[model samples]
Target: MKMNKNYCFIYSLFFFVVSMFFFLFGISIGFKSMIYILEWELINLNSSSVCFSMLLDFKSMIFMSFVLFISCMIIFYSNLYMNLDYNKNRFIILVVLFVFSMMFLIISPNLMSILLGWDGLGLTSYCLVIYYQNSKSYSAGMLTILMNRVGDVCMLMSIAWMLNFGSWNYLFFYYNENLSLELNMIVFLVLLSAMTKSAQIPFSSWLPAAMAAPTPVSALVHSSTLVTAGVYLLIRFSNLIFMAEMNNYLLMIGCLTMFMAGIGANFEFDLKKIIALSTLSQLGFMMSTIGLGFPDLAFFHLLTHALFKALLFMCAGVFIHNLNNLQDIRGMGCLVNQMPFISICFNFSNLALCGMPFLAGFYSKDLILELSLMMYMNKFIFILFFMSVGLTVMYTFRLIYYTMSMDFNYNSYFILNDEELQFIIPMFFMVLMSIFGGSFLGWMMIDIPELIIMSSWSKYFVLMIMLIGGWIGFELSNLNLLMNSLYLTNKKLVFFIGNMWFMPYLSTYMMNYYFLIVGNKIFKSADSGWLEEMGSQGMKKIFDVMFKKNQNFQDVEFFIYLVSFFMWIMILFFLIIFKM
Candidate 1:
């Protein structure tokens, strides 16, 4: 026990010091793009298996600095957050390793070297997500690891494909216009890996469920580092990845994810889950921007979003920690009067997330929307984009109104206060940066791409969406513009909208229900229906759990929405763009 304690503390500090060095080093590099790659050819090693190296450009440096800075703060916050735990040392060790793994991923350009980091991120996140050692955490962990394994398999397939291309280093292949079928497949595999890592649509359930982990871990892993890995990877690979077919697919999936997550967030009762869905929405926004041929804009948003989103998580942590782990937002209200400092943090982050001009998220998000309008695609896609943005504001306003605007709704016996120094210190820095991170990065990263405005209608799109969404949020959440019967009559529709368009059902059950059925029968045959040997007990439990989760899945389905949407989207798109 003593050794575990010392080992984690010493190493965390060591990493903290190293992080400061790299952060300063990164800042000193100061928007000056640098290339550092290392290669070693060993005669004893197979030719194709030789080690390839790292790529440290301006983006990597800035991103690394932000990641390490946030990580260091999270580690400090965890000291107080996890002080009561007996396994604090183990937890800290996992976090440091997670940080190290992200750093490796950021620095490496070689597919082989990057895998070391990518796989490490998957495994460490699995460890972190399941750290509570309870049934809930265990289930979340299984989902997290399984979804990640899909990515790992895709990466392995990519590496195998790249082998025929003569090198393990894939950085060189991004712009090869003349390519074989196998090389094109490599792009698909890479896209799959990014989507899975980032928890984009159809693989997104694990993220919201992963709130089963501790809050500090949530702040680090979910908001800033782990999920962002895919976006970073895509940015690295974007030159070759924006295929017309693939980009269209990405646009659809990403917009759908953004739309679904926004609706989910608005309906989300749990505070943490709402934030988790918001993160999901942001991930979709980034991916869609990449599809829109603005990977640099995507990266810019990625960095800015990280600054405030991490702050948002930390603020939520303060409240959750104080409310004794109470997470339902209905159980919380009018917090601004009580935890004034935290309310500021929460509000700033939320506003920033809404891209409410001048904050970290605004610089990128506004640019993203403007770019979306400029594109010559099916107008419904553009509508989906704006509608998603509006939904983002809607949910954000809903969350704020519920938690900050009304009188306190928590149990009278439960107490809330701003008492923890560790929590306060981390948030103070994060809040200040959230106010300015976007503007700073926007200047540092690139000149804001000149937006091609389509018309007067396009010019006012952002303002219109935000105002309408914000107005609807306050009205719907508080004033009750409509009666309960509307919802009661359309209960299935409401249910589907609220459940993130039932993405969890689509991701988890539909993928495995069939396989689980077969496994159950096989288990019955192998163990004579005992269901105890050959890990049949585990499989049986998993089957039962999934079945119960899926039983209530059909109030509405995405398929229903999809079929109907095809019929109306064209009409709606024209109306939207021409200001009808």
Candidate 2:
């Protein structure tokens, strides 16, 4: 126990110190508007060099710094959160590996080199997801890895296609102003890869299932690093996408993802899953922003979202910890009365998520919304943009109501206290960051002022939607808890929408069920049945019969042959004499 505590503290301090240095360096790099590429020649091929390269600039440095910082906090929180677990040291080690892999992904500019970090994240996260070694965790881990592997394969294809350019240094190609059909294909593949990683549209089911991992792992994977890796990759390739005229597709995908996740979260009752869905919604928001030709705004929102989301997950962990590991929101009520400080932090984070004024989310989210309105979008995209926004607030308020407003619903004997300094301290620090991280990042990331032209109606649209959504959420929360057991109202509808439009089922079961059945039938009829007899069994039986006949013939041969030989000799002598 003491050893685990010491490991956590040491790793946390090491990451904190390193993060500060990287953050400071990133700031300086941003001020100068400079990029430094470090390259090492691994081998020289015909007319090309396979080099390991790292790109150090404002974007990579700043993102890595935040990743390390969040990792530090999560590890510190884990020391107490995972105290009862036997393999705490192994957990810490896996987390450290995950962080470094993210850093490697952040720094690499070469496509070939990027794969090392890319696969590292997928592999490390799979291990972390299955750390508990239970059936549920194993299922989640398999889904997570298999979904990510789709992205991995797409990236490998992209790398192979990039070979036409005679180099794996993607940054060089990106800046060379080359807009060929090949580049478009490459960008399209990259989009698919990013979509899978970021849990967009068809690939969205894995994000919620990933909540089966421990909360700290969720905080790390969902908030900043693993999921956002896709967003970051697209941000780098935004120029190519725009040149290839693919932003429209990206925009549609993003809008649908945002709306789907927002609706799903409202239907969700599990504490961690709701947060996970919110992360998905925010990711959709970022992707849409990128699609709208404001990559910097997307990046700004990504950083800000990471802060608040990580803090939110940490707070949820504390609640679950004190509540004896119950994660269902219906089991919790009036938790604000017992753990007031954590409740405040949790609520504030949710509000920040809802884009409350002056909080971290508001700084970036408001601008994105306003910019979205200013753009020449169709009526449906416009409606989806705001409806998704409203749903965001609606679900948030619903969550707050279920956990904070109602009377206590769970076991009365449970103790809900926030005295664990390790947990509280990390959440406290994240609270401060989630409050201010947005404005600081906005100022630092956005070098030029964005022009805005909107009427009065446009200005008030966001506020109106939020208010209406909050009201709806309040009304929904007032439902008869006694009559409706969380999921009993229109069971089929709730079940369909609540399960992410049945995506998990579609992705996991429906996609494979028929194929597996056919495969089973084929195995029975061919490999184990008719094919077995016709191929090997029939040949063996024929050989066995032939061998038996030969054995019988050999068995009679000795005595019968002697008698026949003598009779044939005497008959042959008489016949020969007659013939002669």
The residue-by-residue lDDT of candidate 1 on 1-580, one tens digit each, is 5565455456556656776776666666654555656676543245566674767666777788788778877887787788789988889889988988998999888788789999999999999989999999998999889989999999999988887766777766755556757667988898899999998887888889889889988898766688999988888878766642577787788898898888888767899999999999999999999888889889888888888988999999888888888898877888888899999999999999998988888888988888777778887887888888999999999888889886788887866788678789888989988997788777767644574757888778788899899889877888643635656788888898887667677667876786777777787787665446436777878888888777645435666777789879987888899995
Give Cα distance to truth, residue 76, candidate 1, Å: 0.9
Give the alpha carbon lDDT tens digit for every residue of 128-216 in model 2: 98888899999989999999999999999999888788888887676655548778889889999999999999999899988888899
Local distance difference test, each candidate: 0.82, 0.90
lDDT assessment of candidate 1:
0.82
TM-score of each: 0.85, 0.89
The candidate maximizing lDDT is 2
* Candidate 2 residue pairs in clash (backbone atoms < 3 Å): none
Candidate 2 residue runs with Cα over 4 Å from true position: 175-179, 481-489, 515-580
Q: What is the lDDT of residue 497 in candidate 1?
A: 80
In candidate 2 the C-alpha lDDT for residue 180 amounts to 87
Q: How well does model 2 score by local distance difference test?
A: 0.90
